[model samples]
Target: MILQLKEVNGMEEGERTALLAIAMNLVIFGIKYVSASATGSIALKAEAFHTLADFVASLTVFTGLKIAKRKTKSFPYGLYKIENLMSVIISLVILYTGYEIILDVINTDLTELRNSGFAIFSLLIATFLTFWFSNYERKIGHKINSPILLADSSHIRIDVLSNLIVLLVVVASLFGFHFDKIAALIVVIFIVKTGIQILMDGIRVLLDASVDYETLSKVEKIILDTPQIIKLKTLTGRNSGRYKFIEADIVLKTHNLDRAHFIAERVERITKEEIKNIDQVQIHYEPLQKEEIIYVLPLTEDKTSISPHFGEAPCFMLVTFKSGTETASKTEILTNPYANIQKGKGILAAELIVKNMVDFVLVKNGFESKGPHYVFSDANIELV
Candidate 1:
């Protein structure tokens, strides 16, 4: 049950974060666009395009998550990784946008910088908001283990750095060195760096990389805590942007097949509950021996008092024969020999098979009359 909730919560958090990014980017884009057009600043223009890139990336995230939530006949394994693919696409788009901004800055001619003072205040506000959004998105990304959100955070982080660059340009313009083109070149580097990082992360997930160490350790701890589980042999996990799949092998000290199955299932259930991000768990069972098997041999009724030819008794068996033969015409014997038998039955020899030395007290003084009769009858010798 907790497993089910964790899966749902992870998805919900990812969707919420994507939506928040889209909304924030849209607002930031509008502010930067207006300021850039008013001031004729190349840095502001590039910053505007950067915010626009974020807006599109956020929209891509929203659509990818929506598609990923859906199940299809063709894709039985839900579309969780679609978001990762989209992040890669968005990264490329951001990179292209950055390149275009650089080319435009290099080609354009700046006649005058208008309303530079107002643009400075706007860039400062944008920087503060970009930092806030980046940190928030990163927090949610770690909580949900979302690749898309992490990618978005990386882009916003670039915006914060670019805004700081633009701030420096505004300050320079106030006191000499009003080189708008130089600031624009710096913004290009900023966007390119962000795009490269985002792309790398998305590609890693698309290639089906395993979840990190912290999550794996959490899962291992859960399996170890399950009742009746003696040891955990192996645990493996992989991530698909928002979903996690884990497989584990466990060893149990149960020879009984039923008990082993029950313990394995419990381990799987506990693992899913204890770990927050796992969507599916597969468990393999290994049976371990409690102790080595000890063999015992049956004995005839008359020879019950005598020890077996092999050694001390680990167990004993009782055999019944057809009528009319003192030598027991037909042989029927019990292999599992830890059983008690009564006297007055057809007298035969009883053999006790043993692992080590063992002693048993005679009951009712009947052993004294039974004597140490070792009847070597011609019968089949079966061990228990």
Candidate 2:
């Protein structure tokens, strides 16, 4: 699903191949049916029935490709699932084809079935061709993760089996036991089994069944990694085609709506970037309760000066302002020197209140925010 028909270009190529397969099946079936009729061989007839099944299956695949490609006005989601439904139909066609082989084998003359050497040879060729085609399709299907192509590959696999059965029936008929009829019955049973299996799988998908555990686990991990996400409570996911849609509810230890909104947006962005084949993501946020913290401001200043006559290294001065109460009366604090003394490098600075409480407050007291009030620790002036 990840690399395959998930994109439009891949879908188009797959559809083209399906159409080509159907046309080829039609040509092969026509040629085999004529040869089988002329030979009057039970095994050839069996092979012919298998070919007929291929014809029907191919047509179903073609129809499915068309339906799958349609973007309906009524259904906003594309009709990609129709391809699986068509595969189910093809399976039924295979079962019917097997059944017809059994019926024809039973109703025909046993004596006429003996001269089917050419028919048996043709079935052998068909078997080899179908086997090769099935293997090729399987490789591509696996690469793209396309269910339709995989189904077609399965159809080819069954064709190979049916041809083998026909070959064996011919050989056994030549060996003198009238076992062609029995072989036909075996083919019928095998086809029925395959048909039932394909139908069940298709129905399950149509019902929106859950995917495997590995996929769910991966999705959960991605959601958990979303930024600012305290916890993920529930996650529900579904897929229409190659795109997986997700809905998740997340919680955080923040009460601010703006923060929650920002976190949700981050979560959405991160989830999309981390996960592959995701088309849409919806996140719901729940705020966790926490205390409303307030800030305290502190006053501070710093200065340096040079003196020539005294050859002093530098003149430095220290000043301090402390808030006596646990909570600063004002939200902001500013500092100024008591005297504008021979200003060489005198400056003023401000700090804001960071933490406020009845007992003690945390303030951005200059030079790295030490405590409750701005402490103007030092100053200096230079004389010419």
Candidate 3:
């Protein structure tokens, strides 16, 4: 039930963000177009067209989010790549807007500047709104882990800078200085830069590139932290739209098939808890091959013999021996850190052995009714 909630909430949040961006773009477009007509500034007109392009891109993002949610028997994995496709489309639109702005700068003459104060005031308002929306949308994008929303937010952020340049150009024209064409050219550069960045990101995801190193490292840590996991063979993750898909292979200390599966499920659950927007986790596990067995025995202060009490032992002896052999290949003595703990010492001792990856524990008697017994059982550590 909790997992279902996460999926539904993610989609709803992405859709809401896209819709908000569309509305903001519409408002900014009207403001910029009105101001451009009033002041006859070429830069202002270019900005108006850029805002229009943003509107189209926002609409594209909304459509993509809607379509990405649909699942069919023909496409069981969902149309998640549609979000990446929308990002690509948005990049193309941005590139076209930049090209149009460049052409306007070269071909159009700045008309007589009028209502200079009104133009500056209107641009100031538009820039403020764009700045606010960009930050807000970016925050939400990261929260929901939506690629399209993040792309749109980046597109809108560039608009804020372009609006400022246009405003400055309008102000300069009032003082009998002309920089409209130069300002429009600068805005074109920003638009093109942002467009290229978004294009690369979309292409990488579409090609099934590996997820960021930071995320993969976190997943590796999670898998390694599981007590029963002896080795993490491979871990791979990729982004599909706003969600992440993961695959991992691991070796568990237990030879029992059911125990291996249980450990895998535990890993999956913990991974989902720590990471956001995980779509699926596929884990493949195999039992450890018994070449050598590591046995831990709770020992007395002298470390020469086993202690009758498991948790109250002052130290422990670790013996490693090859399978079917009686002689020990290696032996080491370790001081029990939790021996002095007044309470829960048994459970802590069990955890200590699990953390050391000991295959078996030699006990004087069965700890069937103790806390340590359950801990050892859960970790799949055999008792001898």
TM-score of each: 0.71, 0.67, 0.93
Candidate 2 Cα errors over 4 Å, as ranges: 1-6, 241-243, 253-277, 290-384
Give lDDT tens digits, candidate 3, residues 308-356: 9999999889999999999999998888899998999999989888887
Best prediction by TM-score: 3
lDDT scores of the candidates, listed in order = 0.70, 0.59, 0.90
Query: What TM-score, to 2 decimals, does candidate 1 have?
Result: 0.71
Residue 235 error, candidate 3, Å: 1.0
**Distance (Å) between predicted and true CA of 333, model 2?**
34
Q: Taking the candidates one at a time, how many backbone clashes does each contain?
A: 12, 14, 0
Candidate 1 ranges beyond 4 A from true positions: 224-233, 289-384
- Lowest lDDT sum, 10 consecutive residues, model 1, at 374-383
What tens-digit string does per-residue lDDT give for candidate 1 at 1-384? 655677677778888889999999999999999999998888888889888988998999888877877778998878888978988988998899889888888788975678888898888888899999999999988887777778888888988888988888878887767778888888888778878888887898888888889988988887765534556888888887677888888876555677677766776677666666666788888865433222223343554553433222322433233333345333323343433344422122232211121122222223323322221111111122
